[model samples]
Target: MNNFQQTARVGLFFILGLALTWVTFETLRGGKVFKDQGYNLIAGFTTLKELKDGDEVRMAGVKIGEVERTRLAGRRAEAVLRIDHRVRIKSDAAATIVMAGLIGTNYISIDLGTDAAPDLPDGAEIKTQATADLNSVMSQIGDLGKKLETAIGDLSGALSGGKDGKTGIIAKVDLLITENRENIGKATANLQEITAKVNKGEGTLGRLINDPKLHDELVTTLDEIKKGAGEAKNFIANAQKIVDQVKAGQGAIGALVFDQKAGEDVKASIANLRAVSDKIARGEGTLGKLLSDESLFRDAQSIMKKADRALDGLDDTGPITAVGVVYQGLF
Candidate 1:
């Protein structure tokens, strides 16, 4: 009875050990014991971002598949995804490896592609994109920190003007004061004297400030200026009104300036004047003939000479002889 009991105890211990080993294996392999009920698709990327087998594949924060396997094919690395058969992944869907958190595990992430696109077939390659790595980000941050430190050091050196012969604000100000001390003293003394004279009412500016009569005169002058300004404003308003009237073609000047019909009439009158002048130049009218002919002057001169001769004959002869001579001359 004792020997039989010992053999049974050993068998029970062996079975317990086997169960523990199986549990550990399942835990390490992501706990998927049964066959995955899904079709496979391949995804290729420059890097998998620490993605491994048995990682969950999610679409829109929901788990729809798992990464079945990963492999290095030629130059690029690839991950085979086992997607749920019921979940339709579009042909244009993209896949990427993303971290769950800063220190959490990485997983394959699928995007919900457009509904109009066809479903991705089994064994088809899904598109992939490379993500920013944490290590690279940390390295960039360190480099930025170093650069910022350098800039701050440079700014400090400029402000403090380190003892290495570099000029700074403080050094320049001290030098300026040292060089102009005598001029500054003279300016201060002159300012004091001018202020004393002003207090004593010894100049025109002082009288302007302290004398009541001058103040009243200044006020009167200012009032006159204000009155003039009002008149100027009225003049400007009248000028603006005239301009508006001109723009509206309301007066003769406005009509000549803004009225199209008036301008056309003026142009027509100018053309008529030109035509008349041309006619006159060609001796085609009465005025043109009067200006161009010389026969009228000759006829007037002959009449004048006959009248003189007739007058002389009247003075020398008797009444009947004078009448006969005048008749002959007239004829």
Candidate 2:
């Protein structure tokens, strides 16, 4: 009976252990019993971060598969992830580590590329991305600590003036205040006085702000100015009437601007001058005859050309040769 009791107790303990192991396996597998239902892809990262075996492989927000293995490939740590065969990953799929829960294990996360992209092949390398975690965050905070130390050092130096016998920020501020104290007081007093005057009403500005009489005066002045403008416009209208009379030839200026007979006379004189110019151009008068006489023009051209040739040869011909040419021409 003692042997039987002992045997029963051992079996019970073994059963409990099996049950616990199954439950642990189920939890790690993310409630999936068969792991071969997914397609496999590989990715590489420099560090594992906190990822583990049996971590869920999620695409977007949906659970797709499980992580198969994590191993060192050369200098990079690589992970083999199995995705649901039904969930087709594109050729450009990216994977990163993500926390499964607040305190749960980290999982492999995938970003699905656009539908227009080609499907990724089995065993293809899914691009891996580094995810920030506690270690990176702590490293960043350490750098921040150093920056904080530098900022504090600079602030201390500025406040205490670089550990030397120089005036500090407080001393400079004090000196500035001392130098400008009287001017600051005067400015403050002036501001106070002006504010008081504005409140009580005194100058033209005060009248514009606080006096009904000033408002009335401004309105009256505007009305008077408007009346004067109306009178000026009336005067301009009468003057325009006089100008219209002048344009109608009822005055000296009118005759100058609008006399039709004078215009006709000017047109006749212009016509006569144009006729004379035409006669000259056609060689029908003295000027035209002179211009159109070709033999006379040729003679003059020959004389001018000879004179030009003589002048061009002057330096080489000598003064005696020039005198001989003038004498021969005279003969």
Determine the C-alpha RMSD for candidate 2 after optimal superposition of all C-alphas.
22.6
Q: Can you give the TM-score per candidate against the true fold? A: 0.59, 0.53
- Residue-level lDDT of model 1, residues 199-287, one tens digit each, is 88879988888888999999999999999999999999999999999999999989999999999999999999999899888877877
lDDT of 2 at 239: 98
Candidate 2's displacement at residue 115, Å, is 2.7
lDDT digits (tens) for residues 1-331 of candidate 2: 6999999999999999998899889777654554456667988999887777777788887888877878999999988887778889987778888876656478888898878879888898888788888767789999999999999988877877755525778667777889999999999999999878877888777777789989999999999999999999999999999999987788866775699887677789999999988998888877787788887788778888777766666657888688777555434
lDDT of each: 0.87, 0.82
Q: After superposition, how far is residue 281 of candidate 2 from its true place, in Å?
A: 24
Clashes of each: 0, 1
Count of backbone collisions in candidate 2: 1
